[model samples]
Structures are given as C-alpha cells and as structure tokens.
Target: MRFQLGWSLVWATLILAGCASSRPAATTSGRSAVDYNSYNEDLSSTRPVYNAPLTNVTPVTRSAAPSATAPAPTATRKNEIRKPNPPIEALHVNRELDLILDTIAIKNRTVRYAPGFRIQVYVGNQRQDADAVKLLIYQNFPELSPYLSYNQPTYRLKVGDFMRRIDAERYYASIRRLISSAQLQADKVDIRRSLLIK
Candidate 1:
C-alpha cells in the first residue's frame, strides 16, 4: 500500500508537470525569460513538499498581545460548576467506587496487542440524538472515526483510541471543561481498534 501510494504520487507529479503551460510568449510583446521560469524543464528549481508552487499569497499579521497596562481577562475555572452537593452520608467510602477502580486496572486485562490495548480514556452514556452527534463530530472533530453501538437497550458511540489512562484523563478533563456531561465510565465497556483507510 505504501509503495503504491508513492508510485501514485510520482505519476501525479509527472502528469501535472507535463500539462503545465510551456508555450513561451514573444519577448517583443512584453514577455521575458523571467516569465518562462515556470515552463523551464529545470527540475532543479525548488518546489514545496506539501503546498502549491509560488502563487498569490497574503501576509498574515500576528495580532498584538494584551499589554500590561490593561487587566487580563479572567476565565472561569473548569470543574468549578459543582452539582448540588450529594448528601454527606451519600459520599461515604463505597464498594461501587472500589469496583469501578478495579474494572479499570490495566494489570488485570488479557490485552491482545494485535487488536491493541483494552484501555480507553473516554466513556459516556449521552442523551444527544444520532443526528446531533453526527453534527457534533462533523463540526468539532471531522477527522474522528465514527461508529454506533446499538444494543437492545442502549446505543453507545466512541471516538479515539487513547492508550494511557493519564493521557485519556487529561483529554477527558479538557473536553469536559469545554462540554459538560463528558463523563467517565467503567472500563468493562469494550474497546476496538480502528482500521482507517488511506
């Protein structure tokens, strides 16, 4: 596949070069050698690896940073929006919490490296409908691999394979800060590797 992709790229480059304008305009008609530089067969001329050759480009201005003369705009702390404090007795050290911890233990799983790790960072049972979710992923994360898990009672959708729990947790925290209800779930929910197409 990698070999085929490279071959395709080479052919594409050659084909594009062959089709470019090569007829030189008469110098007497206000044309010069400078204008034919693009038509020149000199492959020694530098071309960019990723973007188009020199074309109309506008200079980008980096906006000025706020000066010390003005007070910096304050941002609200994430995780500060507390749910109505659950009853103090309800906060007692509980077995379900311990069980939740046990389920996420990386050392306990028989992970198949062929399919990759069993651990995942994000999990949630969300209320957003399929259309809304499709919109969210399209608008916010157009690159994500999307799949729907429709079992008898629930339909779960997931995105991204995060290996380490810490990385996943950090991502989860950042995501939650931006969108409320992005919650963690017990690790018993299965994870599958994505097979992305070129």
Candidate 2:
C-alpha cells in the first residue's frame, strides 16, 4: 500500500511541473498597459489610409550614377531630317540574263490567259439566277471580279483567277457565305487580268 501511494504522488508532481513549464511567462515592463494601448492608437491615426487616389501617390525617381565603362550620350544633330543616298545611274548586268528577262516579259504580255484554278460560284439552267449571284458578288466583294458564261443548257458564274488550288480554296471560303454552292475548280484563268486586279 505504501509503495503504490508513493508512485501516485511522484506521477502527479511530474505532470504538474510539465504544465507549469509549458505556460508563457508574464514580464512586468516600465510602461503600463494603458500607455501601450494609447501608443498603438496614435500609430493607427498617423498612418496613411489605403483608400487615397492613385493620382495623389508620388512616383519614386531613380538617379543613375555613371560608371567609368559607360559611354557618354551623343549630342543630337541640329538637322533632324535625313537625306536619302543618290540613286545609281548605271547597273552592271550579264547580257544573257538581260535577254532572258526580256523574253519572259514579252511572253507574259502575249499570254492573255492560262490553265489554272477558279471558284465556281453558281451553275444553273436559269440565266437570271446566275446574273443575280454575279451582281451580289460584285456589290459585296469588288476585289473578286465575277464572270458569267453560257455553256449550252447551263449558265455558270465563276469568281477569282487563282494559279494554285490553295489560293482558289481561300477565295472559295470567303464567297461561300454569299453562295454556298461555290467550289474550287480547274479552268482557264486570265493571267493578265488577274495580275492587273492584284
């Protein structure tokens, strides 16, 4: 009975000591609690309010100290306007290249039209319907010149002269809003007319 009693007392003492050590210590300062509260209130009053307008805030200016390695700023020229260099009067060109370029230019002028791709806007038996679609395209998209042609029973309305299928497809996408039936097709595209339009 004595041994059990002694063990219980020792356990109780140890638990009490641990709880007392864990608790924060209160230190007595020279200033009273009332003085500390008044100091905090003064600080809060003096501090600037966050709701002030952004325009009222002054921007911080930075001063750049020049270093020994830094290059000095060049003085601005009195005449700000720049004059272009004189154009060269004479250009040296190989005789063979000049002849080839001249031949190509001559060939281009002679060839009025060539086999390429064109966007067919509409194809129907009624000529009036074809004319209506052509007029609509011209009114909205003046860049793409619509052409109407009669082939026996049907009247076809074609727009844009594209040398490549990719170019024709791009044009077809734009005109598809006006005429849903428009599609890219291989036809004799007017080379000279297309160049002039571009």
**What stretches of model 1 exceed 4 Å from their correct place?**
1-128, 186-198
Encode model 1's per-residue lDDT on 101-182: one tens digit a residue. Answer: 8887754466533322122222345546644665665476554454566665565655444444554465566556645655
> Which candidate number would show the highest TM-score if scored against the true structure?
2
Model 2 residue 100 lDDT?
89
Q: With candidate 1 superimposed using the best TM-score fit, by how many Å does residue 59's alpha carbon deviate from the native?
A: 68
The TM-score of candidate 2 is 0.48
lDDT of 2: 0.72
Query: How good is model 1 by TM-score?
Result: 0.29
- Models 1 onward score TM values of 0.29, 0.48
RMSD of each: 27.2, 22.1
| Backbone steric clashes in candidate 1, count | 0
lDDT of 2 by residue, 11-87 (tens): 99999988784434544864433434455334776788766323322233233864688444322234222223223
Per-candidate total of colliding backbone pairs: 0, 0
Residue 65 displacement (Å), model 2:
38
Q: Distance from true position, residue 174, model 1, in Å?
A: 3.2
Model 1: lDDT equals 0.50
lDDT of 2 at 198: 48
